[model samples]
Target: MPVREFSSSVPLWAKRIASAIYVERRRAGLTQAALASRAGVRQATVSQAENDPRSMRLDTLEKILASLDLTLASARRPH
Candidate 1:
């Protein structure tokens, strides 16, 4: 499936992170359980992060991203 862009309205960081992870995971053709195992986290944690990232910890997010060969980055928003 083609990756969908997140709209500007979804401004929350957690939501953005979750959307990114979900997309990358799909692109890599990996299941949630497989990602969880690769990231050394519980399957439920993967599900929760995908469904509600606000509840996820930063370290856990980092680990998940690392497992997918992804990294978190930030840039200043245009004024």
Candidate 2:
């Protein structure tokens, strides 16, 4: 609910990355707030990463990804 899965403005690649993060967070049974707490970031940062990662700092994204048991490299790979 924190992120829109797709949109006219969002690129396919970014969507894929965002989807990966969104799916993993759901799979891990975590809300954006919970993930933020675990990742030591703000809920807004998690939301931004899930919806539009371009604005997110790499370290913040890394923290969120790590909290989901993922790595930046894995998120970049095509599904």
* Displacement of the residue 58 alpha carbon in candidate 1, Å: 1.2
In model 1, the clashing pairs are: none
TM-score of every candidate: 0.74, 0.83
- Per TM-score, the best of the predicted structures is 2
Tens digits of per-residue lDDT for model 2, 18-48 = 8778989988899999999999999998998
Residue-level error in angstroms, candidate 1, position 55: 2.3
* Cα lDDT computed for each candidate against the true fold: 0.74, 0.83
Q: Measured by TM-score, how close is model 1 to the native structure?
A: 0.74
- The superposed Cα distance between candidate 2 and the true structure at residue 19, in angstroms, equals 0.8
What digit string (tens of lDDT, one per residue) describes model 1 on residues 1-79?
Answer: 5544544555566566777778778889999999999999999998877666665688998898888777766211110
RMSD of each: 4.5, 2.7
Residue pairs whose backbone atoms clash in candidate 2: none
The number of clashing residue pairs in model 2 is: 0
Backbone clashes (count) for model 1: 0
Instruction: Give Cα distance to truth, residue 77, candidate 1, Å.
Output: 10
